[model samples]
Target: MAAPTADSASPADSTDPTNPADPTRPVLDCRGVWKTFGKGRDRTPVLRGIDLAVHEHEVVVLIGASGSGKSTLLRCVNLLERVDDGTIHLDGDDITDPRVNADAVRQRIGIVFQAFNLFPHLTVLDNITLAPRRVHRRARAEAEQAALDLLDRVGLAGKAREYPDRLSGGQQQRAAIVRALVNSPRLMLFDEVTSALDPELVGEVLALVSDLKGDGMTMVIATHEMGFARRVADRVCFLDRGVILEQGRPEQVLDNPAEPRTRQFLQRLLDTEPA
Candidate 1:
């Protein structure tokens, strides 16, 4: 497959030149996003003053130690977690606005988690079809076909009839990804998708993600997979203490980190890698 092109559409243009019929704008745009837990004066801020933009077909990877708010940031993008302040825009519409429909906004953005959230009772095929049929009001046959195609895209078509318990960790995770893709999301949010997998199994999920990158899927991934981030991300963002410490091209941030904290984190990660 050919690599997906960057979003050539301007902010003022409502129609995406890359995907004209898709209503979602710019993939994702956020400004001054903040998430704090607890009451005033005792609140713990998970994300503070985050401003980010992701264009169509771009892959931006968020890298940081646990508790750095990477996952919280992803949740904010999809409105899974409400922001105490700031704004989030998806496909050019303000999702953070009170008038915007949250369910409608979610259709344009799909999220996959570290744990495979597959339904145990349902076959992989059913797992992928449920949302489209129920939420999008798609016909059963149409949804099934879409699910099958997504499963094939994620290399899980052969296991579509199998239950979640019958699959390996990597296979289950891939199924979860297919479920997200079946919704035709313009932007995908991956929150530590490989963190729960066994060491050997991580490659399969990463390979699937790499393939998606090749196909030009717009995505924001929060992960600790340094190699994957370096290879697949168009931009790498380092987050610490609820703020983006640094962000730039992968080569600049991963190989030639400018911040002292980023350097220290990378050093520790590299040191822990097996010889």
Candidate 2:
């Protein structure tokens, strides 16, 4: 199947007005956020003054070129990489505060990266259960049961006993997603999760994400998949050189971007796709 052209109406279009999130208290809020790597002259800014608010059950998609800080913004939100300046609040709690427990904050959020990142030695069940059992102090039986249920939900019940290497790319990614879900996170962050998958395998993973959206999982996704973004996102933000240059509903931002840079970026993406 071909990707939707930029002008195509998103499946989410009709549902946009039905899913209004309260702007007063967002599930995730990033204000004046900045991240820079290296020291002194070697310093290179990755995120610059990122101000974004994701409401409960809202899916916000970040889109841009490779180095535009989409991944960095998600990493900072997950507390994987500490920001150099500014603050991030998850459900109004200041997660970026120096005194805040990072691990405790992480328990409220789940993130899946491009790579499956499943432990090779662990069976899929074990890989999925590790966090709940060890970190959350869940009972072994409870965690394993939860893992099995999620695996079943993702159509991977049979593969639960198998190792990551034994599964297809799609299966491994689904397991990673199930692992993320087992913790019952209030928010999920996806960073180019399907980029490593074969073209035919992308749909299964995207379908899983679509199911999550239907279930009202609040999510922040960083992706180059414009069609998927259009389909799933409540809002789309276009990042450029560490800044969000444009943001709006997918149709508004994708179909009729106000910024020249946004137009250029969308054009480049459209150019690379098969006609």
Model 1, 12-71: lDDT tens digits are 233432454655446677767889988979989998888677888989999999999999
Best by TM-score: 2
Candidate 1: segments with Cα more than 4 A from true spot? 1-25
Model 2, 49-116: lDDT tens digits are 87777778889999999999999999999999999887787876889988999999999999998998
TM-score of each: 0.89, 0.91
Candidate whose lDDT is highest? 2
In the order shown, what is each candidate's alpha-carbon RMSD? 5.8, 7.1
Model 1: C-alpha RMSD to truth? 5.8
Model 2, residue 121: C-alpha shift (Å): 1.2
